[model samples]
Target chain A: MTPPPAPVDDFDLHGYVDHQLPPARREEVATYLAANPEAAARVADYQSQNQALGAAFEGVLAEPVPPAMLTRRRPWLGAITRIAAALALLFTGGTAGWLAHDSLLAPSAIERTVAEPAAYAHRAFAGEFRHPVEIWGDNEPHLVTWLSSRLGMPVRPPDLNQAGYWLVGGRLLPARGGAAAQFMYQDDKGGRITLYVRTGIIGNSESRFQFFDQQGVRLVYWVDGPVGYALTGPVDREHLLHAAQLAYGQTKR
Target chain B: MDDIAQQISEQIPHLRRYARALARDRTRADDLVQDCLERAWSRLHLWQPGSNLKAWLFTILHNLHANQVRKLKRALDNVPLSESHLSASTPATQMQQLEVKGITDALQRLSEEQRAVVLLVGLEEMSYQEAAKVLDVPIGTVMSRLHRGRERVRQLLADQGQPVLRRVK
Candidate 1:
């Protein structure tokens, strides 16, 4: 006579579905499931759920890994670059010290002025193919001079070619009760990002690095001296933060 | 040292998949994965070198997601009348496989505990023991959660008048 059929519980069924059961127990559960159509249907349902989940998210595995997530390649280099750049800026000026020291200050009025408008500007223009900016990047010197004169400060668009983003163009908008400069950049994949800048006395202490997300657009804003800068994009935080650092390094006085 | 980094890098795709299933929002999912990677990188030395790096990374991510959920809940509770409904939208057109849409929505509706168990066992294909270790729970809990979660999902789909997706052996 066949040995008494092994008792199969929900755990056994789940184990069978997940392939976690050993060969012996798996066969036992299979026998039990064959005898019970309800259990068999439940097993099939579980298997389909697993398949659907796998099929649903399989695309992310094939999509290109975000550059910010590439820790294996440039993990230490990112930190070293930031530190070296920060040190370099330290000797050139006290901006680095100010950044670290004044981060504890209260929220600046400048954040209100810069973040929202910058996010709106980026959303409005980053996707605009024909008239993305008032001044195209074809003439860098003229664009810089024009923006600097209008904003009453030196306006330099940080070169993000190393980060795989090329200078697209720039435009000027009214912000912080004064002229604000907006520079656009695009990647080879057609992804666009913007840098918004305005100069104003944001009380006594300036911000370190502030992150704000508005309607899917990411804005990283900070204040240095008389100028407030915000980097806006639909990019990931790491990539956007890296771009912001590059902008910070290049725009230092 | 370099070998460990390579191994960890290889798991990024898996982590991304798991995070996507858990967070249900692409941006939040990537953010969770990024946070996991950064944390894992910083604490690499404490990982005992050779023992199940993927599990370790998943634990870090799971814990981070839990903390974030708790914080978000507290923040939401403080708001008398929140604009939370405004953000409860999904991009329906981006779904490549329309059939799986109901399954995904049903998965998201599961309680966080049940959802975690289902994804860990079902999506990530982790063993009961491995899933329990990552979740810091006993194997019994994992089993019960998986059963309840799967049954609930089936009931939810049926309740919506959507046929339960079937797979024949």
Candidate 2:
């Protein structure tokens, strides 16, 4: 009289291991595996394979991008390369004043620290329609508290309603052996943007907004006190800068 | 930088990662990425804006790698697994090194189709649909390739006498 278990096979097993199955179906697969030892062992093996692959190649992500790739691909980056070389020469015998001037003129390491990861995270998550964030914007208070504690500072999602974008939600992301927070925003017509914030930045006394148009994703980032903020969106530089200014304004208060 | 160039530059790290995994030699992998970037740059008009740029870039890399393979007409990895003997200097690091080397060997042993599916889904963390698009295969094909690829990797690791996951039950 009990209903027969749902038919599960290799496809379902792969889905279960890859976490591609829907929640309800995932639960069903879990139940099926409970009674099936062979399927369970296969799942274990698949899981380990994923972990091993991740362990093997993760270092590639941290490797410094080849200089030629960046400069040759975009001839304009050649200017930055020249500036960087000049800065290097200055470092040997330059005065502190020149050092500060060079910092303002050329893109520094701090900019890359904030923008690169922010750009990557935006590309990875901004397109997701389902499970876009760990916590929804509706739980604003709790979200603020949780992110603040984890980041070891008082974290707040900047209100961009004035700029026609409202907080959709946010999620915590790993950043350089520490925790970073990303807040997602949505406007009418479903245009999405993300504000990435990280604390404990060294040598980050303060910096004005720096603009970067990485591919099509526009970003405006700055350092304030102990934290760095990057606002990334698919919008143009003007619109992204407007939203970033709003975020910058709100966070300052 | 121009819009297209900036976008292409953004994907260099990921391209290098996938290429390194596929070619298994840093120099060859880097050359492949350079070729991919050049190809993408030349055909910038074909890349539709607002579409999946990462997938498009990946497809370019995949195609270049395929052509290279055809020209060479040799095995992707000529090095045998036996050559990667595990060192015994440090137990803690040795175990992880052994596992890493073992997985690399296992990946090289897989068929090109299976390896592409495995690395796309496993290393790049692409969804089944995305992996299919990049590989120019159907979703079902992606699933089957992933299953076989993962299973073969498991068997290869077990055969290597390296540490593998054991069933709890």
Candidate 3:
């Protein structure tokens, strides 16, 4: 009437429950359990619980995708198509308007340089973080001075005095036509704004302004004399334009 | 195209069932399955020809579920930590029948990882190696999670006054 010694290791109990042991080893455990009622009862409880859990969730394997979600397309594909359409428009009839306007007001020139910044800002706001910006906002002075010199115009970082954003810094960038400048700014909540600038000639014309929205990011560009300025970010259209206007006022002064 | 689409269509029922079991709610389970199918379609290029598409789909679905759990922080307080008594309809029912509901509620309390491991091995009747592959974990981890998950459920049921049934050894 003596009980058998408890299995030296708990793994034997698991192995027995899971049927993981080789035939001979499993037989030994089975024979041992035959002599030990307490252990056998515990093992049975474990098995039943396992079965019930399986029954509950096994049904999930057969569920169908709802029709609405199935038809939903990838977000990136739509954005890419929009960008391609914009580029096509710029290259076709907008070329004359681009040439007649002042070099800084030329939409084509600004569009080429600002495309990436606009796309990046849109993505950043859309919650894509891996490549939010090529450079961090920690080197503001160098970014401003370097960008200013490259654009051949005295560039001053816009003072977001009332706006919640702060100057993070900037980085040099390669644009569609020439070297470009990207000045980065961040707000308290980690939202970001990028200003892209480049120099180009568009048939010697007067300065003008252009606005565009892509995937929730707003972009404002203007030709001032021979320099093109583009402001890109997730700010509302009015706010982004106001920021652009503020930058213009400071630079013109 | 029709054949591929048809094959995917055939698997939807089982996928729904598995998702329901995982989410425990009908709407959330369907949403999860829909998301899984969308991902599977986009990544169809990566699927090898003639392989067990069902297993591949399951792996993708499980990973997607895990990602959602992490992103939403859904697992943070969902674990079952206590035993609750099942409601009695007549109070004259057998003890074994009384504990069934408690056991199910206890299963819902397991961590997502433990629940997934248990479902794959215990319910789906998959081998440790196969379940490990689907879960993208080591077999040892799967075994350990399954063991812990099962023990917790049993302990919860026992605490709820379920009479332990002795198997004739």
TM-score of chain B of each: 0.86, 0.81, 0.75
B8-80: candidate 3 lDDT, tens digit per residue: 7777776676666565545546656776777787788898879878778889878866654453232112212
Q: Is the docking of candidate 2 incorrect, acceptable, medium or high quality?
A: incorrect
lDDT of 1 by residue, B16-99 (tens): 999888876566577678778877877887998768888899999999878655543432232222123223233455344545
A9-107, model 1: which lDDT tens digit per residue?
888888898988889889889889889999999888888888878877889899888987884434676556546544654686532232322222223
lDDT values for all models: 0.74, 0.74, 0.60
Candidate 3 lDDT score at position A29: 82
Model 2 / residue A177 / CA error / Å: 55
Candidate 2 per-residue C-alpha lDDT over A114-166 given as tens digits, one digit per residue, 9 for 90 to 100: 66667667766776789778899999999999999888789999989987899
**Model 1 clashing residue pairs (backbone):** none
DockQ of 2: 0.12
Q: Summarize candidate 3's per-residue lDDT along A81-139 as a digit string, tens digits.
A: 54554455367643222222322222233443444344443343324346544445566
Task: Give the poorly placed runs of model 1, Cα more than 4 Å off.
Answer: A1-3, A73-253, B80-100, B166-169
What value does the TM-score of chain B take for model 1? 0.86
Query: B1-169 in candidate 2: lDDT tens per residue?
Result: 2786788778899999998888775655776787677667667779889999999999989987775454323211221111112121234655566654888878878888999999998888889999999999999999989988888888888788776633343
Best by DockQ: 1
